[model samples]
Target: MGRHRRGARREVTVADLIDALRRYPADMEVRLATQPRMPQEHSIGAIAEADGLVWIGEGRQEGYASDGVAERLGWR
Candidate 1:
């Protein structure tokens, strides 16, 4: 159940909620409203609705690797 807003209850921002949820994979239907130029989603749904893999990487000088990529290309 959701807590009712009271005079003493603390307010939580959507960013805080998203940050908390980022610790786990999102598997539900979620729609977030943001600024016109802002991102609409910060996470991906575990249940894919499309074919092919979506590669998401951290913007770094060197990123992590997955052997699955090589196996998929028959290079393993």
Candidate 2:
């Protein structure tokens, strides 16, 4: 009889999220979640958290335009 083989489970890490997000267009929205007080910017890049994961996405624009603009405007 042949022994059964099992597939390895992949672990998602902060780096993994960043790589995946980079594949998308800048205009696209990437969602993740991370520590509230985490450093928002880095010397080589920036980090964003949404839905419990950290990802690298587009940087802030000159006019502060954002895909989730509606949500931000609601605070006022």
Candidate 3:
């Protein structure tokens, strides 16, 4: 994938995300990853849409990811 465009954002539709996930094995875990510099993962929680925006809950932080995650995410 290309490097993330600075300050660029793309709105992903539920169908779009689902289609992408369909390629993965069903037993794989799903989590939210953010704070790229620190590289942590969180549990996936409730998903809802309000005010024309869909929100995915950022569940509790599970733990810091291994060094590989930062490299994979191209955050370094």
- lDDT of all predictions: 0.40, 0.45, 0.81
Q: Compose the digit string of candidate 3's lDDT tens values, residues 27-76.
A: 99997778888889999888898999889998789998867888877778
Could you give candidate 2's per-residue lDDT for residues 1-76 as a string of tens digits?
A: 1112454456667666568668889887443322233312212237678888775554433233333443433322
TM-scores for all predictions: 0.25, 0.30, 0.77
Most accurate candidate by TM-score: 3
What's the best-to-worst order under TM-score? 3, 2, 1
- Model 3, residue 1: C-alpha shift (Å): 7.7
Q: Candidate 1, residues 1-76: lDDT per residue as tens digits?
A: 1133553545454565668678777775443322233222233324332445333332222222235534433335
Error of 3 at 49 (Å): 1.3
How close to the true structure is residue 75 of candidate 3, measured as C-alpha lDDT? 78
Comparing 2 and 3 on lDDT, the stronger one: 3
Clashing pairs in 1: none
Could you give the C-alpha RMSD of every candidate to the true structure, in order shown? 18.5, 13.2, 2.9
Residue 51 in candidate 1, Cα distance off native in Å: 39
Q: Which sequence of candidate numbers ranks them by lDDT, best first?
A: 3, 2, 1
Candidate 2 lands at a TM-score of 0.30
